[model samples]
Target: MTKKVLYRIATLLGLIAILFVSTASTWYIYQGDTPEELL
Candidate 1:
């Protein structure tokens, strides 16, 4: 049971990390295209 819980937590963390990276990259690219608007 404990192992299952840990696995779930790890999976959640991995998904969150992936989403964070994707969002960061997308924002970075968008800012590159529209530097004036972001500022």
Candidate 2:
């Protein structure tokens, strides 16, 4: 694959990972856990 395509894929994966982490953190917060614990 071209470098440009690979870079785009990497960026997309990074964004998805951030989204997942934020969602998980929010869920944890609602479960009575601090977000710092997740970090």
Candidate 3:
């Protein structure tokens, strides 16, 4: 594959990873009805 193709794939994968992580983080922060341990 070309370097440009590889870089695009890498960037897409990174973005997907970031989206996945942020979604999970938001769910974790907002999913509960009680006080968190850190609060």
Candidate 4:
């Protein structure tokens, strides 16, 4: 029971981390592109 709970918690944390990384990467790319488009 403890193992299953730990696994679920780990999976949730990993997904959260992945989402955070994806958001940051997308934001960074968007910021880089907007300057060129404006010019």
Specify the highest-lDDT model's number.
3
Model 4, span 1-39: residue lDDT tens: 999999999999999999999999998888754666667
Poorest 10 consecutive residues by lDDT, candidate 3: 30-39
lDDT of 1 by residue, 1-39 (tens): 999999999999999999999999998888745657667
Model 3 CA lDDT for position 7: 100
The Cα RMSD of model 4 versus the native structure comes to: 4.6
Q: Tens digit of lDDT per residue, candidate 2, span 1-39?
A: 699999999999999999999999889778874578667
lDDT of each: 0.91, 0.90, 0.93, 0.91
Q: TM-score for model 4?
A: 0.79
TM-scores of the candidates are 0.79, 0.74, 0.79, 0.79
> Ten consecutive residues with minimal summed lDDT in candidate 1?
30-39
Error of 3 at 29 (Å): 0.4
| Total residue pair clashes for candidate 4 | 0
Of the candidates numbered 2 and 3, which has the greater lDDT value?
A: 3
